[model samples]
Target chain A: MAPVKNGRYLFNEIPSGYPIPGQTTVYDESETIDLDTVPLNGGALVKLLVVSIDPYLRGRMRRAEAKSYNEPFKIGEPLMNWGVGLVLRSDSSSVKAGDHVYGYFKFQQYEIVDATRVLVLENKEGLPWSAYVGVAGMPGQTAYHAWKEFAEAKKGDTVFVTTGAGVVGATVVQLAKADGLKVIASAGSDDKVEFMKSIGVDVPFNYKTTKTAEVLEKEGPINVYWDNVGGESFEAAIEYAAKGARFIECGMISGYNTSEVYQVKNLMKIVTKQLHIHGFIVTDLMPKYNPEFYSSFVGRIGRGEIAYKEHLLVGLERAGEGILDVQSGRNFGKCVIVVGEDKA
Target chain B: MAPVKNGRYLFNEIPSGYPIPGQTTVYDESETIDLDTVPLNGGALVKLLVVSIDPYLRGRMRRAEAKSYNEPFKIGEPLMNWGVGLVLRSDSSSVKAGDHVYGYFKFQQYEIVDATRVLVLENKEGLPWSAYVGVAGMPGQTAYHAWKEFAEAKKGDTVFVTTGAGVVGATVVQLAKADGLKVIASAGSDDKVEFMKSIGVDVPFNYKTTKTAEVLEKEGPINVYWDNVGGESFEAAIEYAAKGARFIECGMISGYNTSEVYQVKNLMKIVTKQLHIHGFIVTDLMPKYNPEFYSSFVGRIGRGEIAYKEHLLVGLERAGEGILDVQSGRNFGKCVIVVGEDKA
Candidate 1:
């Protein structure tokens, strides 16, 4: 068989700050693979359907020696993240042809992968294929576990969630609202703030124009904080936290691309107000929470009780642009790239 | 009944930085009280025996309007803190003449206080009277509950503790050692570091002479951090914290007395490491933990399985100096003042 176009995105450089579009990560249509003749060797051949572009992927664009929870992206190789794909051929029992699967998928149209690396996805609820990589996926699980276990939230509690229009924060904001909490959320743009308001956020503000601390001081003594964009907002949360406030530190997107990271001045408030600031990665809790989250949240989302939003980028060629959109706060909701045709 | 000398310490000013020994807090012996026939309406007339001087008091020295976990000390009034006292006279059922008690007692030779405020101190282990205000009291409880509940510790875990020779840090160091942890403790003085070693600390360093971050980088990726002094050390702890590290924020004495507070730069580590930083007051957990702690620890101390230390300031005239000693890191152990003879 002649080598067919694979169309992959490669990690080109370790970013010093915000990744440069087309330079830090590059999409090369010239890359190809022989699907029919390539050696499977007890592995499965899969056609990538949807690839998730998330803020956390920015942390992976670092030197291999830099230590973190996730391994650094290998330069000149396909940059990977949570993705859903259609199993085209299988040499193992876990996944079969025509079955939809999800796992840490590379940014490419086709791949030969270990059968064990992919989990067969059963879309019995008949939701969008992209939803599996969005609300019903990593972001949803992160919001669910961190909010349920660490927020220690109660009815009538005032919750402040940063990055309110983003996938993780939007999920938490909705969860808090459903649990009868007063939700105050923030976003970089006015349109995102409007989206937050549409979803029943009690006080939604554009942090670009409004002072986070002023809003919190006037409308809060925040009982719980779902922090995604950690920086000045984090310091403000610390300053306005009520006694025994719970802080769920999911992401620090504001400081993710900057060398001159924000210095938190009010950390002393942690002692003065007896605050509880907890940081967690969703992967750690996924083994226990994924099934639970999917079981409960999928139906709610299907029935229109919980809303899920996405910013979709079509084709593998746009993968680099999608990630830059997410990193620079240009993308709204759960940013996803459609890499191949969704045959499912 | 003739008037008798009633020596007392009064709050004279709101300090800008470290409390000035005689100006911020003053000891006056010119006032007198009628001890023979003092009014005791549903209260008790008590003779102050030993009064505690702690770093946390620096927080209470603020203006009355500054909200914190504990109320600010009222200016022009007798400064108050945990004290052991002898009941001279009583008009309530809670206490009687000749009973030894402990409470938030005034810094004076004699005072008429609400009888319910003071609890009868039954020294079943035959410990020193001053021990009730030191290791067997609030500081000890702070160490015990914060360590047991929040540290999430296991055997052989490396633990870092700041202000290692102070009551809270010393107690936590001993507790971690007993739990089979590798204890790394820091203090301002070489003498205090030696004291930490004597109490079974595996790694004891004088933070003033040795760089805290350098030592932590060399010997640790700290699994549990019992933080008392929380400025530069707090930042260093965050930098060196292992994945899933637990930070027990009992006090921020480093920032308590100053307007120029330290800015923490490495809070991003909280996310990358999935850390849990919990700040709690000993008062909040006392109901559940105090009895449990006393039952286990008092016996341990009595049997010589645990050791206790004290820095005794003789006479009521030295109360101001004692507090300054605590604030400035001059106190080697639990700072306490001998206000009157232990008539028990």
Candidate 2:
């Protein structure tokens, strides 16, 4: 290796509107990879095999005055994000070199990282390795923990999910269904709706055409709404939500690109029905309570009690396309970048 | 005494828009008050004094076929609603005559009610009787229970209340204040802002001038948002709300009159922050769990540890003005009708 160096995609400038082509402004390719030999505290560096593209990342690229969950992507710094990787070398006791793990690496081929913010890809032989990046990964955990911890979902209860075709959403729909709740979802396209139905959503509505209020009225009432897409969908969910409902607002993807949002018509439904709407960060939920939740969830998936679809993209070079696809609702399931297959 | 019969304000026609001046017909002056003398089994006759004129009532009036908190107002019959009254008679032995109570009364002066759903109001003299209709009542309990039970508020937490000058918002501000939370409120007018400040809000902003997100950013993070005025206020609250914040949706007054509604930006904040925005109705909170809460609440009010303000419209004749004032932000506090004083 000729004088190893950091390889990362920097946020050149904030994107306007829906982050059109070249809006992310991926920087130059790295001259040398940030190898494991670097003086990182806990573990050796790893080469990123697959990176995840999420719609929420667009929010961080904007010029925010204060920091949110992870720091807002700095104007001139490489956009910090989550990824799956193969450890090239190890310095920590828990994880070893060549061990496939899911961690928050940079948007690059290789990253010098600490082991604290990582999972050892437990039950690796027990489940698909890529699953550690999909349903078994952050997206999977997001849906599972949110539905399990907050929504207070019970069997026979009705559960509605906004953006029900996305990674977190699809996962929520299946999990809620597995729990014996009648699951309903809102997707951007008719195709996504059909896809959602195939995966066990009792009803799937195209948010673009079907009015959220109309669907809720048709559906009558829902006990919990696992929100992955906010805005008009949220407002609609407010109107249709059952009495004493719980709204776990996981994301508001619908309002990310827009400057303003659609208001809810029957917001008072919360006070009158005794509904609980709470906002939380996955990172806060992850270490604090996700272990037992995800473990059981993964068990559900393994036992065929739940199901999901995977929308995969090939090559690290296709990372930009994957991100764009997610932002546009073109990716129905987990949009993952395939760098290479793990031989571990 | 004339032939006495039960009276009720019936929904004559669905309101296409705000009833055109005199389009809202009233049945205040009536002598045939009681519908029947013999209490039918499972039916109770309630003499209602104070009825809630909430913005949500407007949605229930729309001609569209849909299920709501209550069935939509029939084309020519009475609208069943929330109110406080004296139980004139009860067919069920579970309740006795002359019991102070509240329930879904017909929007009228009196009605031979079905007793099955009646909730007896016990020991209500500790606080202002009007509070049973406003704060310490539906609106007040709405604010307190949702904040305490759903939001799980803590001292030093920051709370954001929309429509802070309105009945529900006012109660939320006072109750959240008692809880030692830093409270910021959104008012439609400068006077309302001042009123909110006088009542107890740490800071009050005119929603028309200052934006919720901008002001919320300056006030520090919001732990909970009691939303009564939906639209821009709610959208901004989602963006500006702190991590792990709970948003209690109570009403959508801002766009209740218009065909068009305001849109929000940054809905993605909900997922990233993991926000819970719940829509509820107060009738569902377990009465068994609320006695202690009500007692402590009333004690605080009686001791002046918590003080409340009421906007009383002298008679039922001006009920429209009172309702309009309450809806339009003209009323400075909880709007009520002085039907009669409490006497055994």
> Can you give the TM-score per candidate against the true fold?
0.98, 0.80
Compose the digit string of candidate 2's lDDT tens values, residues B68-145: 666566765655546777776677776777887777666666666666676777754565557777666667677676
iRMSD (Å), candidate 1: 1.2
Q: Identify the leading candidate in terms of DockQ.
A: 1
Interface RMSD of 2: 3.3
Best by lDDT: 1
Candidate 2 lDDT over A1-344, as tens digits, reads 44554445667767766765445656446557435346667666677777777777886877767556766777656665567788777778777888777777677767767876676665633766566677777788777666667877689999888888877888888778777998878898888888898888888989888887798889858888777666667777777777778888777776676666555445545555667776666767777657686657678777765567777887665666777788888887778777666642
The 10 consecutive residues of candidate 1 chain B with the worst lDDT sum are B298-307
Which TM-score does chain B of candidate 2 obtain?
A: 0.85
lDDT tens string, model 1, B1-344? 68989998999999998888789988888899998787898899999999998888888888788787888889888999899999999999999999999999989999999999888987888888888898888888888888878987799899999888888888898899888999999999888888888999988999888999999999999999998888899999989999999999988888877778687777788988999999888889888898887788877776767777899989988888888888888888798998899772
Native A-B interface contacts kept, per candidate: 0.80, 0.77
Rate residue B7 of model 2 by lDDT.
Answer: 48
